[model samples]
Target: MNTKFSKLSFTIAVSTAMIASASLASPTVVSFSDATATSTSGSFVADNAIDKNKNTHWEADTDGASITARFGSCQRVDDLVLNWYGTNKYTYSVQLSKNNGATWTTVVSKTSGKGNKNAQNVTDQAANAIKVVGDTDSRLRIDELKVNSLGSTNGCTSSGTSNTSNGENSGTSNPSTGEVSGGNAQYPADVLDLSKWKLTLPISLNSPPNSNKATEIKQPQLKTYTNSEYFRLNAAKNGVLLKAIAGGARTSTNTAYPRSELREMQGDGTESAAWSCTNTDHGMYLEQTLLHTTTKKPEATIGQIHDSKNDLVMVKYVGPSFANGSTDIGKLEARFNNDNITKLLDSTYKIGDPMTIDTAVTSGGNVTVNYKNLRSGVRSSTGTVKMTGIIGSCYFKAGMYIQACSKTDIYNNTNTVCANKNLSANKYETDPYAYAEIEVRKITLR
Candidate 1:
């Protein structure tokens, strides 16, 4: 329901910067046959993805498999164009391998695949190979795989865009590979550099008895939050992982809104930091991969973007949609603007079944959400409203906010212990609380 900088000025500045950074030389488009192919499963396999044949497809046996394209030499690959066959959702990462695949770095993690633009910009990287790996609900039927430079004198090639020639594909594409434009590798933050942010635990509005206004249940400012035994916030190969100790605190309040979030410094809309929280004409963009361990009732949340105070807007992952009002919650749904709740994406999420979320909120009230469920190769998008509160002083937060409340406190405001039994402990108890855990791979801001 709610949501940059001075629109006109910032827009002009950004445009000028873009003009200044333009490359004079044309970029080389790596051919499909340029790299070798390999995968975790399937035969028409890795190579087929780039074989320039709509009739050929690569299928994985399991849900989360991989298809890698290894080049002969290190190439500065900044963007890619992939045409997928069969209309299914996919959650996958476009990764670059510099050290021969023993380890890899992610260029971008995509969660919404259906109707995804063929050209995807990733971190500007020099790697010998690039691969797509993740979870899929249906068999993989990916075609038209081509790699391109972030900025090329020549645009993406028409030959790179795929059609439904193989049969099951359905969608509308102008099919122009002409210099598939891309963004620069401008990731500013990592796990080690989250010092500017402050951790606010279990803040919520009072229910029946505690008064009806939105207020803090227990707004303790823990100084060394990221250093918790039950929680971990660390830099991963390409992104960051915000995790709750496997047996960490899940709930910390009787209020339906139990939270653990990070708030940015006041009026410090700096873009040079690890991640940009600036409200500019260019706006601030954040992309991250989310993974969870629990599917319990009273669905928990994963990622969010908030203002200085008040939960303006956020993403809530309901293990089983609460609207059904039944625990038949095997199917998980990604709900946006949980302050009012709008279904953005839905599927069954497992520990390894990663979902990639791409969000861009403009200085204006415009917000865009793109979701992908890896192997399915299908992506979905939503254009929603981002209120104006945070526009002046906004920050991005990614972590678990369990919404479970103890039965004793469901109707009465008496039960002090949160559902997860994290807080409200005796003065003698020193152990930490069990939390809803999440691993955030990468966060990039522009």
Candidate 2:
């Protein structure tokens, strides 16, 4: 304890203090040379070596033998860094295996030549055991090998200082953490809109008007449902839930009847007198449900009637028929292709009318249907029907239904007798006409 102690005593005191401070200040950097070389029965040789800069480190030499450093039983190192000098490019690939090297997966492969000393980061989305494999150029030397954990660690905190592991800095946080955080997190623009959230619309909205003029005049304009608005509006307020009714007629009579009477009798018995006196009116009705099975929304419907002896007629009838039987109707007709109709029906028509032709094989073919007569009318029986041009191959389905209702009175006074007696005296003949047609086709992409 004397003020001037011996040199040995002074040196020992200083050394003791230095050791204690070093232990508390930093983690002990255990050089690979100090640690025992872990040996396995495999071809890998684990050893400690000094680098060209005299840095002590661990090394795995696959020099003549393949070497791998295994971690614990289940998790293997995912990344490694090697320091070496070499000539004649050396190619090596990193392999990984979860099953103790039973099956190795190649993660990274690189070639190094003279003046090559760098850290390589090996990342494998799927890897368990990480090691290096040498290619044709076998003169390989690895000065240092460090393993790194692959995925993100949830509840672990790394020492604040940068530590090189798997050739990447592994620490609690990096200087550019803010940039990384901002780049990874993003939200969609429409997520905040509540108006777009619910699929159903409010009931206060109005339903749209029907496209059929005959149906429109007899039906209230407000009462008629429009396909456009019906989806959002409540079904009860839309209109009457009536079945779809449609038909066509061919008459030699050259007179254009007034529109008012024609709209009143559409699909009903009000025009029995006119229907019986003329021998030329003919048509059919094709109807389906309005709402789709998946959407439950009002949708446009299509109807087609094929007459083998006449022309194949396809009609797209909009709702809300006219009071005067005068409304714009979309019609298409063409000569039928027996083969094409068969295939279209086979694919879409499951429950409806069967196809007259086999639709399975003839996917590409031409068909035609002629529109000999077309007309818009208000009363059920009397309206100006025009003859439209023929439509060909416009429809995917070919087979449809056609029914003929003919009113015949041998005595020309049938109309007068019915008016006076108020009795059903007109001779009515109904017959089912058979024609080849395809089923309805869905225009949705598969």
Candidate 3:
């Protein structure tokens, strides 16, 4: 054979062999609902390995780096294959988590892993998330991660949507509706460091006929406060659950919507946080999942930076077919100045998928936002917004700030009175159970 043709034939043969091996390892390949890593090096990101492309690889920046893969719902995972970068030996371990990465149980451990491929039999284990940890001192590199499920379900719920059931449907009784026994009751502060933050509830501190001003809890009080109905820990006591109802109280007489959110505070939370956009750079990050939304208007603002007068940018989720004759399935959007908007993630976004939101504002008043749909490995960014001469002082807010309310929501609570009568009316249920929920696992500010 000609030399060039011979080399091409040999390459094809190797590629074919690798594909066959992958097929055998995963008789029924299970797609990852979401993938995330602690860190990555260069262009080799975590999603690259999960993309099932041998040509692209993920390299850890340091040793002991780990990547997590979550199924949309529960799965009976039995096999996991790691496509290593080269023939170098590696030490690694695989673990399983049933409580959404809160706790883990190790199932596979290898001290001397060789060749370009390594396979481990994890047995038939029930898990919603799987983690592979690099045990070696050197960087862990992988081209792909192949997983096999042994059952008939692919993890999606019956409604053809991703299952993001709350405590009631998650095999655990909801604290809001029932008493939670065992494990000391955890507060939002316990799960997240909230020393520099304060909470704003959807309800008022006083009764009706009095001021309907939304209640604000600061330091000392926030450290120990946990509301079963609005802000508290999840059933597992591993994440903070923020819930808001359309009939909930508003922030002020001028405000239209209700929110169960957190506001950045100054120093020990004794004073309101206020900073000029030209003073210093600011950033905020959150690892959260939207659990539920209102029926007709399934929309909520997850994160945002607001000025003393108006909001600068908002990381929001708009539900499917939200407006009349609209074809939108759902989307993660970055709304700038409540005017210009950019879609970060499209219809693939689901109710119970892991989402990462990172946004920053420069000293020059330029704003930018990036979103990662961990479940679908989709990532997008809003390049930058030039607002040097347009905006002023601003602060950060994160949680479930629902962008929905109806006259029925107001009429539902005959005791309280709302100033905004132009509010949209509920079109779905006679007594709209307009509710929204978010599970915040992690948050950071800088």
| Candidate maximizing lDDT | 3
| TM-score of candidate 3 to 2 decimals | 0.60
Best candidate per TM-score, number? 3
Quote model 2's TM-score: 0.21
Clashes of each: 54, 50, 3
TM-score of 1: 0.44
**TM-score ranking from best candidate downward:** 3, 1, 2
Query: Which scores better on TM-score, 1 or 3?
Result: 3
CA deviation > 4 Å runs, candidate 2: 1-45, 49-64, 73-80, 86-88, 111-115, 118-128, 135-139, 150-446
Cα RMSD to native, each candidate?
17.8, 31.7, 10.1
Model 1: how far residue 225 lies from native, Å: 7.2
Q: Candidate 3 at 1: error in angstroms?
A: 60
lDDT (Cα, tens digit) per residue for candidate 1, span 245-346: 212222333343444544443223223122233344212223334454332343556666655454555666565433322223333443444366565564
**Cα-based RMSD of candidate 2:** 31.7
